[model samples]
Target: MQIAIDGPAGAGKSTIAKQIAKTLNITYLDTGAMYRAITKGVIDRKIDFADQKAIAQYAASAVITFKGQRVFLDGEEVTEGIRTPEVSEHTSEVAPIPEVRKVLVQQQQRIAEGTDVIMDGRDIGSTVLPNADYKFYLDAAVSERAKRRYEELQEKGGLNGKTLTDIEADIARRDYNDSHRAVDPLVCCDDAVRIDTTHMTIPEVVACVIDHVEDGTAK
Candidate 1:
């Protein structure tokens, strides 16, 4: 069975999906990280994000790994490289490309083969795993999301000296792109259980999801 979690940036998809996957004894795949990895590839290869052919070509040949919670790109252990401020900016540019999303979707589907899996991203509920047994759409207010992202970047110390204002602006810009993309845009599936996490804690959010699942209303 595959449980898909779809949400915007900083809506707790990664943390929540990981927790739920652990409880259900399933493998957790962070699809957003894959896009981020590809974004990093664009940076390394100097491919123009708007050039669909160029981005698609790089994505087609990209290698990504998840050793538990760690992410790697190619032969190098880019677990940290892909999450840099630079990748954060270019990932939105890369994520909306039709060809790039198609390639990543195929890779994501392949990872769910023969395993109980939980995958999270902007379009998982709508595009990647439309038939997922359990679908969740997590969200938070824009200001709240901006705050969460700001704090997270502060903790990671990966902002590369960028200001909090810069981070917030970048996240907001990505939000617009994600919601308006022509292919596999960010949308909450009607059947997906929506959880507004603006004022909720991690454990509280996880419990709500668990309760919903146990009651068969999560989808």
Candidate 2:
């Protein structure tokens, strides 16, 4: 069984998807991290974003490995490295490249084959896992989402000294980039269940998702 959760930045897709994966006893795949790894590689190689061919080639050739919560690119641990604000900004630029998404989507599919997995990202339900057993689109008001992101960054030790307003602005920019990307842009599939998480707590959201999974809403 494959489960897909997709949404804009700060919508709690990652946190909620993790809990859902745990409840379903399946592997949790963070597809966004995969793109970030590729972006980090491209940046490290000093490749210009204007060189689409080079960026695509870099993504295709890069070796990305995941061990539990740890992420490695080209055999180097980059779980936290990819979270840098720089990587975050560059990832949005590269992720929409057709060739880049092609390579990463293929890798993501390979990881889900013959296994029960819950994958979350901006385009999972719309592109990566369109036929997943259960599909969910998590959403929240921009303000609420930004607040959640700010709190999360605070918990992660100030997120490189970024202010809440800075994070909120970043989230807004990401939302636009994700939704307007030319290839496989972020969108909720018609069959997906949309969950407005603006006022819902983590446990409440998880319970709601699990309830749908337990019932016949998604099969």
Candidate 3:
């Protein structure tokens, strides 16, 4: 049972994917975190973003794993490390590189080969899991998405001096970049169920997704 959920940042993809996975007793794979892990690695190694070859090579050799909600790189835990604002800022740049995507997508596919997995990211439905048993595309207004991100940062005390406006602008930039990238850009699959989550609470959104999954299963 493979479920692919695609969405831009802060559209609640991770939160919703986690909930659905828990409810269905399946493994949840944070594919965005995998990209973020590579981004964090490149930043830590002081590699220039313009050097795609170098970044791709790094990604090829990166050992990313998930244990519960924690992310690990090369046997070291980097859950909180990869979530820093710096890593978040660079992840968009790293994710669009075709070579990097090739390496990571292969890893993701291998992980889902036989497991009951729920994976979420920008291109999961369109690229990583095209034949997934279930596919969903979740989206919300940029302002609402940014507000959620701002609140999350506030709770984590990791705002890093960024204002709500700054976060909104950044999200807008990511939406454009992710959608416009040449290789497997963010897209809603033809068969994916699209959900506008701007006015819905997490529970509402989760229930909607569950309803779809149940309806499909019943068919």
Give the top-scoring candidate (lDDT).
3
Model 3 error, position 62 (Å):
1.1
The sequence of per-residue lDDT tens digits that candidate 2 reaches over residues 1-219 is 999999998889888988888887899999999999999998999999899999998888899998987999999999998987789878888988999999999999999999999999988887888789999999999889888877877777757878778878888898888888888988988999999999999999999999989895955
lDDT scores of the candidates, listed in order: 0.87, 0.89, 0.93
Q: What is the C-alpha lDDT profile of model 3 across 150-213, one tens digit per residue?
A: 9999999999899999999999999999999999999988899999999999999999999988
Error of 1 at 69 (Å): 1.3
Residue-wise lDDT of candidate 1 within 1-219, one digit each (tens)?
878899889899999989988887889998988999888878888777668898898889988888988888886677788778788877888888888898999999988878889999999988888889899999998788888888888898766777767767877888888999999999999999899999999999999988888888875
With a 3 Å backbone cut-off (N, CA, C), the pairs that clash in candidate 2 are none
Off by over 4 Å in 1: none
Candidate 3 lDDT for residue 159: 99
Clashes of 3: 0
**Once superposed on the true structure, which residue ranges of model 2 sit more than 4 Å away at CA?**
158-161
Instruction: Give the higher-lDDT candidate: 2 or 3.
Output: 3
Q: Count clashing residue pairs per candidate.
A: 1, 0, 0
What is the alpha-carbon lDDT of model 1 when measured against the actual structure? 0.87
* Greater-TM-score candidate between 2 and 3: 3
Ranking by lDDT: 3, 2, 1
